[model samples]
Target: MLSVHLLTLIALVTSAKAAISPFTSRPRLQTTFSGLSDVEPFSLRLSPDTAKVCNSTTPGTSGFITADDGQGGNNSIFFWAFESKHDAKTDPVILWMSGGPGASSVGYGNLMELGPCRIASEGGYTVDNEFGWNVNATILFVDQPVGVGYSRGQRIPTGLRDSSLAMLRFLRQFMTAFPELADRDFYIAGESYGGSWVPALASTILRSESRSSGQRGALMVQEDGPNLSPNSRRGPKINLKGIMIGNGLVRRSVQNIGFFETVCSGPASLFNSSQCLEWAPRAMWCEDNLAVCEVDGMKSSACKDAESKCSAISKVVVEDMHLNPYDFRRECHDPDSCYSEMRHIDEYLNRSDVKMALGVPENEPFVGISLDVFKQWEEVGDLWRASDEYVNHLLQSGIRVLIYVGDKDLYCNAAGMRLLVDRGLSWHGQPIIRLRELVPWYLGTKSAGLWKSYEPLTYAEVAGAGHLVPFDKPEEALTLINSWIHGRLPAL
Candidate 1:
């Protein structure tokens, strides 16, 4: 009694699985880069790690890379790399993350979004994703912030700041192990909570890079000294190019302005007028609380108070309407399964063979999304506040930033993202204004979306897509990414 569409989905899933075998005979963790000769001050080798050939057909590596946890202990940050189909030596290195504050990039970014392959819905096999983003650039999907996935650590990070620092340590060590990647053009990309994560990490890197002064092939990480400028301090630098964030939560205050618009008058009329009317008072109340929170220090109780008040709008919608916060077209199925593929990814990653192949511990269970991490952030009042400052910092410092959204998303909709960028951003003490008119973006013969640019900042909206833009519009997403990295608008 399966519907025609459902039957077709199963057939495609089965056929796709046949194309990509779950196990590969090729040696694991092989790198195509020419070996490093010169040693750098910050360079340190990663150890106590195990790796294997996880996929024969897929190129590049998958393993846990050890990073110093800022504490004495070492934390494992899980990574899966899809080496570029083009020249690995010159192509850009793109690191991807999916936001949950606790989400697994290996699960959401890899298995569900832009990885070279995907897990079958029932979780028994793997399938080739032709639209994977590794076509021209090396893509590394990292499970970050510790305790998110295959990554393990003695302590869990409390918030974005801690998570960003851990990631910085991990990146340094990871690049050192594969020294050839150090000089390549690097980019950080993520979504959702990653809105905060991407900019925070980018700012940290920029700050470090600015203070370092290195000549020839040597770099040093300064531990302590009088603060110096970029020309004075001598250390290594990540060859950062730009960042791309998909439907991210940039500034909650700015985004909240568009919340009522989307919920009440969105294309689908997802909420009744009576229900929508009830939110006006709550929205105003939250706004007043948020204003007070903004003036209060980052760690002040007022911030937590504001976070609690503003969060109710979405909470009530989720609790009462039962709509998937990510998309208006579907009902959220269950508490355990937030998105459609959560269960499938959990099953695929936890399989004994799969774990052995990827060098994950056999005993530790895999969690697609860690509710514990989520709760921890809530407890510490880390969810609210704004990332516009970081974004502005990046722009003023010449780091290109792209914010793209799926028009169908209910949670972080295009309207909200547009509001965040157009109204919420400022650079060099001046408010950011659009440099170009919003225009149709093309993918082949069809109009895929709309895009507008403001020099280092660009805002895009993808048609027929939801919160998880890449998963909802793979081909268009790939095209959009390629265009962004290549310094061209996606017109083809």
Candidate 2:
């Protein structure tokens, strides 16, 4: 007899798989966008040459659009679209967003991560990645909020927090430019800080469609009733198929505190120990209106010392064990090596294309934008919360929701995602976990595991991946996503 867990897993997978059909049945739709009256519509084409890395053909296209600032300025939003031969119009569209609050989706999000391409060599062109997401659907790589990538803006905006507005403007402009693709099914997807951007953008589309009419307008609504009535005046509801976040930073309060606690304590008891240490201090600080933890002469000194020690240890682990290819145990660990790596990253960013993609001026000083963005990331977070609420409202009104995460990602860990799902949305019952084993997993030859089916929403865990699961395990990620969008769940 099968174990109860395994039985439940099979049932959930079966139900999910039964939901949608394969991509072959769906035809590709020509995409166009509005708001860019000046630019011309163009079709995406495959590069004649195959990539050297994964030895796969990757498709790409370039286009321009008029993006809005919500505050009043309208700028050009240039973009690259990558699609696999298997992709069709009816296939779900995964819109990629890179973190950095100022990162380039094309560089990191595409070449290095999810898209079909990977950097062949240092400062070189890319090759196709076999693990790319395009095998199932169209992957749109955008340089967003203007001023990022080849996209240009009049004045560099500072601390702008309205991702919802930015998305609304971009979509409107994009659709206007690519009117032929108005009917394509779309899903908002991103990583790192994108945890906030994708949700917020999806929410904006949901809100907009709630007031419009037609198939595109009704896309956000659930398949079942409350059907549209003859007398209804509101626009057609926007259908949101699902959302995928890799190494996300969705729960600001939890992630910030958790990171401090998790990496600060000794490795053996780190996770739990950090939480306990934080509990008391956080509770007291909250009760005292944050006054108790405020920086002061003696307290400041202690805090600084603690921060240095934590930083030192974290640097060593993250650099030596994580990013570099050196064996963690055998390599001689050097504290300064971490600093040197940071400097190397700085030098890498100095490349013109990289600087352009990052929206950084050539002469501007390079501080840690990742940390700085965290400090000022609340704006995007607020937008994300609002968007998530809107999406849930759509669900309550009959829309199905799907959320996925990559397991190996430290930034957007599975634990944080679970907490977000549990607290952010109310479900009909307990979430279900369905595990599917992928043959010949990368890094190791063992089979990989994927989780599926969490109530009305489908939550998946992609194995053997980090912040960019698609980049590391593209085939599995694409298969899982394609299956989810089609409503088919894989067998474990």
TM-score for each candidate, following the candidate numbering: 0.83, 0.62
Model 1: which residue pairs collide? 210-230, 213-233, 220-235
lDDT of 1 by residue, 1-492 (tens): 000001122356553432211123332322111111222122121111112322324535666655446677767677767777667667888999889878999887887888877766666666778887888888888887778887778888877778787777677656644546777899999989889889999998888677655463322222122212222322235888789889898887778766777778855676688987877888777655665655774468777677777777677667777877787677875534666577788777788877766656679877777888888777776766578888989999989998999988867888788877777788753354544457899998899999987678878899999988889899999999899888887773
Worst 10 residues of 1 by lDDT: 1-10
State the number of backbone clashes in model 2.
36
Candidate 2 lDDT at 441 equals 27
lDDT tens string, model 2, 1-492?
000001122356553432222111212212221112222222211111122212246445444554344455556565666554574555556788887676677556766666676666443445667767777777778766555654555634433335456556566544433333345677777877676677667766776666655333211111222312222222212246666666665543333333333334445432355455655464333323322122332134443444343234335355645532111222334532422333343445455554444333456443323343333443332322223444365455545555666654444555556555655454443333323222322223445554545445666666656555666567767676666677765544
TM-score of 2: 0.62
Q: All candidates: CA RMSD in angstroms? A: 10.8, 13.3
lDDT of 2 at 401: 57
Model 1 misplaced stretches (Cα beyond 4 Å): 1-56, 216-236, 287-289, 297-306, 428-436
- In angstroms, give how far residue 438 of model 1 lies from its true place: 2.1
The Cα error of candidate 2 at residue 426, in Å, is 3.2
lDDT of each: 0.70, 0.49
- Give the 10-residue window scoring lowest on summed lDDT in candidate 2: 1-10
